[model samples]
Target: MLDWMNRYRRNRMVDHYITQLGPALRKRYGLREQYTVPQIQKTLVAIHLNTHYLAYAVALYRHEASRNTVNLRLSQTFLDSLRAEMAKRYFHGRDSYRAHDVLGLVKTSRWRGGRSADGVRSWVAGAAD
Candidate 1:
């Protein structure tokens, strides 16, 4: 019960923050009613984390928008802000491997294909070396 409540609370907070980001984003992009706050939030989160499914969804959603518009809206500063917020909320104080630590191994790995999904997996596996 306690765990469930905590999860629910966290979810609610996420939703709230996403909702708050909506207006700022819409205003930034000068988008009228085409995209809702929830949609924008989901897309931003997807792009920030480089999530496969969500990234696809966001791509589909942006099919109507110009590439320049999409690029400008999903700027690095915005993505980094969202990433930092998410890290603070979910991964604060958590021990994790930094990307640089594995970059050398990944770069040196002999994957069959270059930077494909399977290649990335192989790189990750070989990154232990």
Candidate 2:
């Protein structure tokens, strides 16, 4: 598995992050009820693209798997590291880039706060902004 990670990391760290993250993301965030299949697919594609960029940043900084430690807990420190890296990459230099695509994934997630399907849709759509 580490070998595969190394191979993927060769091209772009984002690719490595996506390869590790895509399936987990699909399982964790893909919604069956928020929208139709086509809509969900579209959302998934957008989310995947966005996440890939984040993965790339994380990889570029040698932060692959840094978010979760051997203790098996997700660490805010890891996320802060990634976020700081992203900010530096996206905002500092003229040639830098931001993960706007990944940021867009915020709109595609399903919210379970509603009492009914319609309510959920309203809540989600409302919260999207």
How much does each candidate deviate from the true structure in C-alpha RMSD?
Answer: 14.6, 14.9
User: Which 10-residue window of candidate 1 scores lowest in summed lDDT?
Assistant: 97-106
Which regions of candidate 1 are displaced past 4 Å? 1-72, 93-129
lDDT of 2 by residue, 24-69 (tens): 3445555221222233234446555443343333322222233223
TM-score of 2: 0.27
Off by over 4 Å in 2: 1-11, 16-24, 31-74, 90-129
Residue pairs with colliding backbones in model 1 are: none
Report the lDDT tens digits of candidate 1 across residue range 24-113.
Answer: 444455544344335654646744532322322222223234444355475434444444544455456221322221121223246566
